[model samples]
Target: MFKVLLGVSRWNFLSLTVLTIALAAVTARYQGAEIQQLQLGLVLLLALCAHISVNAFNEYFDFRSGLDLLTSRTPFSGGSGTLPQQPAYAGVALLLALVTLLLVIGIGLYLTWQLGGKALWIGIPGVLLLYGYTQYLQRSPLLCLLAPGVGFGVLMFLGALWALGAQLTAGAGVIAVILLLLCSNLLLLNQFPDVEADRQVGRRHLPIVWGLVPSAKLFAAFYLLAYLLLALAVWFGLLPRFCLAMLLTLPVFLLLWQRINKALQHNADLVPALALNVLLVHLCPLLLLLALYWSNTATV
Candidate 1:
């Protein structure tokens, strides 16, 4: 059971779920909205199940593509390397993903019937994008990078909205959309190191397609944009004043940018993986702070 769980790649799947929960809770709290326990539990279950499915499917496919052939892939390989590098059977992982999909489809279908158009039309597609992301688009042009942002905006927000059975405010929805694009761009920059290996397997990532200089510039551009959005998120009255405290993340971001820039100049592999981990740690707390702030402010 533990091995199977590890095969699912919690960092890729579960981390997003945790991030989503925090974002939704923050949005709700700022509005003084009430949260439901039963609903939140179901939402979380759906997120985890789908996340695991994506990870498993990604593992199965990246292996099929020979992406695990690259050495020095540890410390990062973006989570799919574990099963494939070990020569684990994609068949087993594929089956697990299917089981998770069916379970979620069942729950999502019920939620749709009970909840209506938004859940099915909006929510399900949000979930389905994870498939397009890992399975197909991860190798596309800019699409590879853009896909994650769309998932962040669509899947995370829709999931939270569905879970609460509440209509999302325009402000919260917009904030989530910007967050999605910003964070997704951050994720793309995170893939810079894997570009070579991914290309060796015909993955053609943006960083690889554009080359190091362009990729690094694009990454730096987005990194700045992300901070701007965080600021705007506070200035616009969408979140509490304390949310501005996320600015404390700036120094870390600058450090990462410098690292990535240095890596690009020298064509080093360490920057992408190290930078991504740094970003993850930086953002997780900001999201959690927002969530906790929301929880404290909730009407109960």
Candidate 2:
């Protein structure tokens, strides 16, 4: 049951939230701002609950909507395989999702009252995105790209910044936009494999709405945008020069891009690309975290 819960939570992807929070915290440190450990812990707890809520709710909704049965489960795109095998767990998953969402709301309210009302600026949309994405947002082609991107990227990053006692600066704004683009592209690429299943259930994700080839082209463009924006940020002195460490992931990004470019026709062909993309997602933020840490310590 624990293993099933882990699977349903999509624990692997939860690291993205952690990395975003860490990036914000590390950025705070680099800027010589102090973060309350307790506050940071509460922020992380809320993020975890929100992530699990999204995952579990997604599983429950897909199972109810019959999308899970139609999907050919892949290592990446499909809903967790737990529900298709154990249909009885559906109610439990839904309950878990709602309970966690409430916890997130409670924490968010506390953070808002403690930090600033700006927390609501990020929090309200976050709650809506989590609950609506699987049902309503997924049906809107543009939102299918933007919702996850905004929820994980901009909202979480900004929320973390506020929690860490940093005023939202232009640099943080740059990071938020870059993250939004990266995560949006991540969802865009992963949608390719599930296009058929998603279509049957009325999901108009990028790969479906734009056609695979165009979406692939845009995916490639989004990758370049991430790097381009980072370079610009560093050049403009918004981010530290050491942020160039993120360039280390360029080779992996190139490999994934090449795979997507060359063989997008076959789902099998895109698997390695998907895997590489996931690695790049984690690796880029990780490198940024390290860069911030290095910058902080070097100056100290």
Candidate 3:
């Protein structure tokens, strides 16, 4: 049962939340904000619960909608396949979703109480996206494309800044936009292999609405824009020099782009592209986090 719950929640994917939250914390530190250990811990718990709730909800809803059975499971895209295999545990998945959502609400409310109403600016939309993403938002192509990025980049990242009492500096805003582009592209590419399955289930994501080739092109454009923004931010002194470490992934990005183009152009396998997308999604933030921490520790 424990293992099943973990599977339904996509426990391995929760590390993305950890990386995001850590990046926010380090960014706050870089900006000279004093981090409170207790508040940081609560924020981490809140983010984790939010992520778990979304994953479980997605698992239950996809299974209920028959999308789970239809999808060709992949390492990056498709449903987690837990409920399809363990149908009896469908109820458990729903329960876990609800319970985790409630926990998210409780923690969010507490943080709002301590941090003031500004937290709601991030919390309200986060809760909405968490609940509506797999169902309602998935029906709108543009909304579906942008929702994941908004949730992670704007809400989670900026909300962490609020909790840590950090000012929303220009550099942070640039970082947020970079994250937004990366995260949106992350979901965009993952939707490729699941395009047919998602369409059958009435999901109107970019891949479904724009078709794979255009969607692939958009994915490439987004990544290019994100890297350009990163370079601009550093050049303009919005981000530190060490943040340039992210450029080290440029070769990998080029390879990923080639793989994605090949997969789309020649109907080649997409697993490698998907894997590289996930790696970049995680790696970019991780490198930035380390860079921010290093900047904070370095003496001027």
Best-matching candidate per lDDT: 3
Q: Which ranking of candidates, highest TM-score first?
A: 3, 2, 1
Residue 90 accuracy (lDDT) in model 3: 97
Question: Tens-digit lDDT track for model 3 on 16-108?
Answer: 899999999898887777899999999999999999999999999999999998989987878788888899999999999999999999999
- List, residue by residue over 11-73, the lDDT tens digit for candidate 2: 888888888889888977887788889988998999899999999999999999999999877
Poorly placed runs, candidate 3 (over 4 Å): 296-300
lDDT of predicted model 1: 0.64
Judged by whole-model lDDT over C-alpha atoms, candidate 2 comes out at 0.84
Question: Where is the poorest 10-residue window by lDDT in model 1?
Answer: 291-300
The regions of model 2 sitting more than 4 angstroms off are: 265-267, 296-300
Point to the candidate with the largest TM-score: 3
lDDT of each: 0.64, 0.84, 0.89
Residue pairs whose backbone atoms clash in candidate 1: none
Instruction: Encode model 1's per-residue lDDT on 1-300: one tens digit a residue.
Output: 456557655454466566666666556655566777877777777777777777777777776777655634544445555565466556777787788878778777777777776667766675667567666686687777777666656666656764675556655655566566665665666576676677777776787788867876776676576567666765776555565566666677677777776666676766464746446544844653564464445321
Where does candidate 3 have its weakest 10-residue lDDT segment? Answer: 291-300
| lDDT score at residue 86, model 2, on the 0-100 scale | 87
